[model samples]
Target: MNMLRPACVLALMTLTACTQTWVDTKYQQSDRFATWVDSTPSPYRLLAGDDISVVLPFNVELNYKGRVAPDGTVAMPFAGNLPAAGQTLAQFGETVNRALAANHMTANAMAMVAVTQTAAHVFVGGEVGKPGELALTPGMSVMQAIITAQGLLDTARTGEIVLIRRSPDGRPMLRTVDVKALTQQGDPAQDIVLQSNDTIFVPKSSIAEVDLWVDQYINKALPFNKNVNYDINGARSF
Candidate 1:
């Protein structure tokens, strides 16, 4: 009996070790991931849909709020037709200044152009506390965006938050952010600068309990002859 007890104990230890090894192997395989920059520069440029405030200190009466037309130009009284698209605020100001000077409207006109309204905005959708479109503001940050969205939902996969941005060449780029790390670990690097037309998506938690209910409903809907397995293991479930 003593020898049998020792053999049983040895077998149990072997089984435990094997189980641990399997778990470790699975974890190692799942660890294949990539890290990205915490903060990135805004890739958005002035487009046809943007609204700008053009101020001419030389003539406040001539100061106007201009919206970029479909053809990417704004109509100004003295400035005539000026191209406002594809230029930054500073660049646009320089252009307007040059135009006014050329037309002899103001010899030394000091103009300040700013983005008063942005028609290009970022959409925050899926599993966030509040899923909606957020308007882009000057000097907006990712942290401010999340806050505007009312923070992450309880089922939000903080590590899997995705930022989708479009490049100048019109190619879409994706960046994964660890929002929990930013909030919990106080990692400023994770607080990225936000741009117009960017989309921030917070995916639902992979550990959602509703998946089991969905699987059950699917099993019920399947025909009896379909040979569907009702067991969780049979469904290859998460």
Candidate 2:
């Protein structure tokens, strides 16, 4: 069996930030998201931040890839802009197929839509074995990402590993996770599902000023409690 993961490239840098709010993993659940581990992924609905690819077998020259716009649409060469968000890849594929036929490009067009990148990613940085942007597959956990990074370094502070996520309004929400206790005490709570654009920075030592470090060093942000509640007939906006 052959497996692949995104390469880890790192640079030692200080984690600086401004005043931030933290949701500790000890007492509460930070976010609510559906997991798609070993399940049919076709049901995964498209979101604004998701990146997709469209392939028109009948018109290969018109093939294109791009991110779903915030307005819930994706612009293609001939298709112009089609409703992409709130629709599954399969559903959107059919939409593209019809658009090609309507445009007289092909009467029997079978277009395929694939996700080149999901809306979220798991970024591991700081004192780790190999820290970089790790792919955030569906149902991926924090522990899994840490292991993929080849486990934490000895100099890494296990007690205060920082999990930085974005609020819906786009503000950074800092959280402290104790990986040491999670592994030593058989605690599952600490191994949270990595959210969209979540950054797990393993500090070499305790962070006296979390806000200052995050504001100064971190760039990517994520949201919490995100859910896609839509039915076959209609779609929901995120």
Candidate 3:
């Protein structure tokens, strides 16, 4: 614990006094994560390796089914290859329709894009064994993500785990969860069910100097894998 003290001091000292004020105003502490999070779900964006089926409403013969290529495209029946990754189903459908109409493949080019499969994931970092992205299985929770990340380090401050998630409006919101309750006290309520694209950041030590660590690790250090491209929020399931 004392070993992490220097890092805490160095991290905190680098910031100006106003930074602390900003943190206070910026990260509101609340158990009601749903309130801060957007109410609606965002459309699923296509990604490399995601399986999808394209249906031509008018030209049924040209319907195609395939996976998004590693280069972020799909090979179609008539339009050849079109970019699929990063675009939502509706957006991708529009792209396909435009391409079909331009080439005069069909008079009515309205198409439907259906997601057959997706590689949903969540990121876990800091004070964990194997900090990286993990596949987001149904009902994945905070405890599960930590365990999948190879579990926590001896220096982990489980009481101050920071969960950053994007709201429906696309704004990033944060929550501090006390997972120590679940790990140490066996309190099931401490386990928070995660969303796809959610990130779980366990702190190294004291919450007294969390601002710097949050800025350093949560903001800059961790890699935000574009899978689901989500910052996670929680809905309880205990």
Candidate 4:
């Protein structure tokens, strides 16, 4: 037991050093992730499931509240289906006007589209007091998300917060942040702004090495394969 203890401590120290090296080279030195933190995102585009209010002055009957369908379209009273997702409010209004013209409903139809309820979302998990999906508000930061999660638990590792986000091009990426610097030292650089579909994971101090420790301790305990596993009855069930 005593010999095993020193091995564990040495392993932890070695892992910590490797993590610090990774944070410096892979994250800090990378320029691709800088855009997400440094640059402000473009205007919020309409998304599926967004509640929109459309007003048409010439055709009052056509004016109604509708939600964007899963296929990125909204059914208008006279215009049929119009693409609402991936467009700003102004762009959506233009689309409605063009649709109205194409249908010969009106020559100079004016449409005003406003997003009554947005569809953006952020996910918080791991050692937070509350871990779940949160509605992504305009200009929400990482710190705000932690607060919304009811703050970190006593066992949380503040310095090892991980932010997982998908780039605009649809590639998944990760960034490491030090919450201690952001909160205690007042470092704005450490507080990254959150985006839609962003996931913030605040790991516990004991599992700060993340997947490595999980693979060592947790994965080994589970007796299962990619194809089969035991059910609740403790029988080998497919």
> Any runs in candidate 2 off by more than 4 Å, and if so which?
1-81, 85-116, 205-238
lDDT-better candidate, 2 vs 4: 4
- Scored against the true structure, residue 210 in model 2 reaches a CA lDDT of 50
Runs of candidate 1 with Cα error greater than 4 angstroms are 1-44, 166-172, 206-238
Predicted structure 2, TM vs. truth? 0.47
139-192, model 2: which lDDT tens digit per residue? Answer: 677789899899988667788777766555655556677898899997877787
lDDT of 4 by residue, 25-127 (tens): 4664465444343457667788998998889898887787989999999998778888888998889999989988999988777898887776787777766
> Would you list the C-alpha lDDT of every candidate in the order shown?
0.67, 0.67, 0.71, 0.74
Candidate 1 displacement at residue 224 in angstroms:
13
Taking all chains together, the TM-score of candidate 4 against the true structure is 0.58
* Clash count, one per candidate: 0, 12, 3, 0
Q: Which candidate leads the pack in lDDT?
A: 4
Better of 1 and 3 by lDDT: 3
Model 4 worst lDDT run, 10 consecutive residues: 1-10
Among the numbered candidates, top TM-score falls to 1
TM-score for each prediction?
0.66, 0.47, 0.45, 0.58
Q: What is the C-alpha RMSD of each candidate to the true structure, in Å?
A: 16.4, 19.1, 16.3, 13.8
lDDT of 1 at 18: 36
